[model samples]
Target: MDFRWWRRSFFGAFLSWVFFFLRFSCSDKACAAPEYTFVKEATSAPPVIFYDYIIIGGGTAGCPLAATLSHGGATVLVLERGGSPYTNPNITNIGNFASVLLDRSPTSPAQPFTSEDGVYNARARILGGGSAVNAGFYTRASTHYIKKVGWNQKMVKQAYEWVEQVVAFQPPLMEWESAFRDGLLEVGVLPNNGFTYDHLYGTKIGGTIFDKEGHRHTAADLLQYANPRKITVYLHAIVHKILFRHIPGTARPQAYGVIYKDAYGVRHLAYLKRNSKNEIILTAGAIGSPQLLMLSGIGPGYHLRTHGIQVVVNQPLVGQGMADNPMNVLLIPSPLPVEVSLVQVVGITKFNTFIEGASGLSFVYPLARRLAKRFRLFLNQSDYEPFKVPPEDMARAVDTVNAVVNRTLRAGIILEKITGPASTGHLELRNLNPDDTPFVTFNYFKEPEDLRKCIEGMRTVISVVNSKAFSKFRYKNMPIEALINLMLTLPINNRPRHATAAISLEQFCIDTVMSIWHYHGGCQVGRVVDKEYRVLGVDSLRVVDGSTFYRTPGTNPQATVMMLGRYVGKRILQERYLSRRSKHKN
Candidate 1:
């Protein structure tokens, strides 16, 4: 076998993936979107200003909340610590789904962080938040889930419809996605609910943010509903602390304002307009919300004192009960080439397991390098870098080029994450710098129940892999099958995954655990925030994102998160209206 021919094959397949995507795939319409006049750079913000509501983190929930509040004639200022997602090709193009996650640049939309559990995960660092960086699977929270959270079912339905109109669509199934759907049913996951957003127990097709053309619609698009004149959005505005003041008669620390730094390190202050109803909202995500709370002197008294932060509220549970859905995946290499697709088909099981799958996702370099190493390609470490040895069909600049240029795999993954992970962890401030990630340890599978649930989920996945509907895609006798089976048992970073046999499923669950990015809690519902999501011991401040979630909603949390923004925004407006009417009567 000629080694040069094998290397050429690598360049040929990889370059073809980039050339067509950048050249033909990203047309002008998809490449650029009209700039929103209301969306401004953080540097341009006034040194001190006031608004009816100050929203921190212009993410999935923040965007919709801002729009809802502004539409109701209240002035809203949304401070986002990340860049706009509109023009980012890695984000806008659904086909390049993995590119953003793989790009480890400082300014990448996905902020990559490794957990203490040694699992690789990323948090959203873009205007649209996780919706801009996620797999785009959109499914609503279960009816039982909504009721448990104490949200009005009718209002939840209306809010979901509002979000669906903007970002949700029934994605057309590709060859691989269709096969995944059939396999789920073949394995008796349940009745085929077929292309619906209802969170039923069955093999069903959920909505996606990706359209038929493979262009993604993010939470930023929902900003179109915002009243431009009333809502002001500032990108790269990092809120370091929530400002609190002592009201004359109130014992609680009143959140009156926030102190933030712009991208260029200029300090800016935004305050509430001094109305009793005016509030400061933290829509910053799970990790961000809790970290910010600690930095703002709102966490445990001892923890804040250790960091030299003056404790405003001694809330011990601010960062406690943090949970991430532990996901385990089985990679199946196909004999036939598969079409690229993101999350579309799902298998919601009866036994607290939710299974989702994606196929032909060419995850930039790491996956490609792993595949190349498996195939035993005669290539040095430098050869893999486009800078040192550019692929024959592309330029040397391809190394720095923000494009998905590697397509080595033609495989599908069957992944499962348990609904309510009994095991949880806590997040603490590593430092005061808002840019730095906080110290977090989500003790995955610490609870015996969680490990047991994972074993059951993986067993269902094995059934899907062995399903007759999935048989045609793979040649069982192929050498790739044996290679993947061997790869499954190998250890990563000294953590050994047990063999994929039935008896060793427990160890496999512990070793192979990774985050599906459905991590929630930190500022939990009852402990850190009230049922209305208002921060406990702090007046005029609330957390509206996943931080307040006790359990992840639906097959994915983005849909419910986005809906929560709308749901809460409407409720706030209604509360204000009723309050005004009561004052008039008095």
Candidate 2:
């Protein structure tokens, strides 16, 4: 075999596998059937001519809202900007979550935006939206996040109960649990606090996990279960604008209907019939929800003018206070030669099966509870108060982190900087194109404190690696500098070498770092929507999902997002129905 032929064949095979993975594995699971035929059906139909409550964007927030609102006995129409993940091959495989970053997969429609910043990473162009392509790790909103939005503990606690009732929370079976446990115990980084699969929030460990059936207990699952007989879920439908009316005497504006486009590219507007009272809910998520509002003239007047969009309401809070989890995976080598396990692989299969049949372990709840009990070691227990400790304690913690980063140089642990100061980014409109990717400018680590946090995170990981238990495993930290050097040496796809040289403690806070693709916070509380998630100046519109969060929780957002969906859904239903009877005389 000549070198040329070998190289050509190897690269060809590699690319083939990449394309295959992108096609069949999207939903953090595997699939047995195509996930696009339904999208075809949705697109072929003419625009919806009638609906009492039209929920746009069947993503995280939209899914639950659609399902819950339909439970109100109202005629509901769910308009998804993308195709159904159930039918899209790109959404079943878990591994495709990483690969979809480079190319436009089946779910990611042509985005109308791009960014010099690396903040808002990728947008899913399918039915389940980001839920179909996310890491599947589940944690609810941090207390800081809830309070930041002016939601009291009682409200968030209630939201958690509502969310947990719908989502199956657990890890995989015994083997996966053992692996997670052994991995943590082996490193001796066992958390000192109690874990939570409960009502409380913060850095408490145990999070909601996917069961063997692949049902993630996400907004998608809840929506399906909570869906009402009157609600119609239409995949591949994108809402274009919200139809509004200026009340003749009142100071507030009223929403009457919505304009949306089906998969066939045909546009249609469903308006409120004369003398008919109707409410249009915009659960389109952080980006889509706000974008739709802006398109309908509901954002900052200046910003709207720049995009040639006429102003509906001069709500300046639109598109501000975006936050995301600064993530970086700390890679640890196996003590023994690595063995490929189908545990994660099984999750792939289960997710796909659910998309096709909506049954099996995917529909069970006990499976999640069992799984959560197994991976309790790596859980962190903290109140996650922003200023819990004194300033001196924080300063000392910063010093401790610096010391660990320095000491790791002597030990063999190669600290891979994943979520560092340089990972800070933001979400913005790339241009006037709504379908375009947003301008994601992550000026990561432009601030010094952020750099200290990354260094502290590195130190924390090292503390786990240096423990007595981990030493027994003899985990040799590979020479990470070598890996960094290799990446720098690469001709193409070479990233900026942010950690090229070690810095002194005096300069630690000033250093830069990279991102981990954990994008968050474009429509946070106290800004985008009020505590109840109602759009500030608009009636019957709300913002939910990751974007609505004030900040990314210490862990992943899937579980938290599910909670938001459920909480917001219940609140909307209550305010719309329960509060109404008291006001009526009939």
Candidate 3:
């Protein structure tokens, strides 16, 4: 009766069975090749071509504009740097929102980068741009913002309807999102503007790009308006520079064409129709637009000269006044599993803060643990400064930090974004290389009021979590009180000496706050572009993306960005028609 031998034999059999199961369970499946009949590969495009309009960066604004222009009978060419979003399953599925951003492939639709101040950020490189990668929240710009920008209200409303028909939807509120909505209302963020797309104060459930089936309909879908025969969309076409020609007696340079490279590294030129009032428009995002402008020698004269680029225009404000909405996130672990959801509930507090919540098993288990560990380190270490860490260490730190804040798998996240902040940052060219990303410093919390508002937001989150609505779920082992105390330890500049501490609030913000990715300005109206959305100091060049925003609206900016694209497209068509009529009269 050898009991030990029997036990060892049982253990060996169990191990062998587990390995056999894994071997079969992990077998790879062959995937079918994706078809992209709507888009043309850059390598197949002619080396030199002409179009009635050459739109660079087929993104959020670019896609819609190309569709509108082509529908109006103008021959359009859209040059996009990233591949088609249709074939990327990570982008097409709403459940993979966070995972899509973690894609670090060289040609990933979402390009990840660290800002100059060491804040981890990402920009959309695909045809649909941010709309393809962002958390599916959708809300129109505030009426105040629309009037401030002086847009035609009627046209703007129509534009919103046009976009909503294609990409916007009303998400079904599940258990987690329902609880969040109740919590927001319990905290006095009242008058639940139920299921409205308008940007109003107080709690509201806005529109989403995710339909009932959890599928994402992106702005790229709006390309249906494009006349297929009239529009030529070249995927993986990276625009290097806007070709400008000097006209005698004109004070500014005229943008005539653009030089770009295909996916195969072959160069090509796209020119505007000769003897016609053709234009080259830049619909690149906030960072890409400013970076391209500087690369084309349209930024500060001194800065361009230092980079050995010949100055075309001395626009000092071209890369200045860059601003992004700063975000602070608090994770609440629960014993009960929270239902999966995106942003279906929002709290618009009186203190100028926008609070949104989401919870679910959205991320892979391994990634969730790594992110939780990183966040614990970030909050626990009082002296943690990402900039001081080495590149390798900083990357690990950022990954951990971003994983917790950005993903909503296994825990609930309360994200608070400052709707408006006076503090602003600037973008500068790192080098003359077109492949180099611009240096972004989002001088967050530089203003004392900014920190005060953020503190108020943190307190609001505590109130919402403690409310009766979240009573069912038990709070796990997070040191919520300790985190709140750390926020209170921040030094107030104007407060009494005893009330203030040696650790300045500004530094705490620099260590904790991250970009919510609602970037705007750099080429703003009244400074860089006119009210008509045309880039100043350059003829036939317009910026029709978020970069042209006078100020970042007080909500998720996708709706407004799309509205502006439609608005500007209508204006361009109207102007063209008027010109033709005047010529006939002459």
lDDT by candidate, in order shown: 0.78, 0.47, 0.72
Q: Give the TM-score (vs. native) of candidate 3.
A: 0.84
Compared with the true structure, the alpha-carbon lDDT of candidate 2 equals 0.47
Stretches > 4 Å off in candidate 2: 1-41, 93-103, 109-115, 118-120, 142-162, 172-195, 198-209, 213-218, 272-277, 333-335, 339-426, 471-477, 480-495, 498-517
Task: Give one digit per residue, the lDDT tens place, for model 1 in 466-539.
Answer: 77888876545432233234334323222454433323677667776767889999999889998998999989
Candidate with best lDDT: 1
Please provide TM-scores, in order, for all candidate models, with all chains considered together. Answer: 0.87, 0.70, 0.84
Q: What's the TM for model 2?
A: 0.70
Query: Which candidate wins on TM-score?
Result: 1
Ranking by lDDT: 1, 3, 2
lDDT of 3 by residue, 220-269 (tens): 88887777888889989998999888888988889999999998899999
**For residues 399-458, could you state the per-residue lDDT of candidate 2 as single tens digits?**
432332332211111222222123444455556545655555555556665555655554
- lDDT against true structure, model 3: 0.72
Deviation in angstroms for 522 in model 3?
Answer: 1.0
| Span of ten consecutive residues with least summed lDDT in model 2 | 350-359
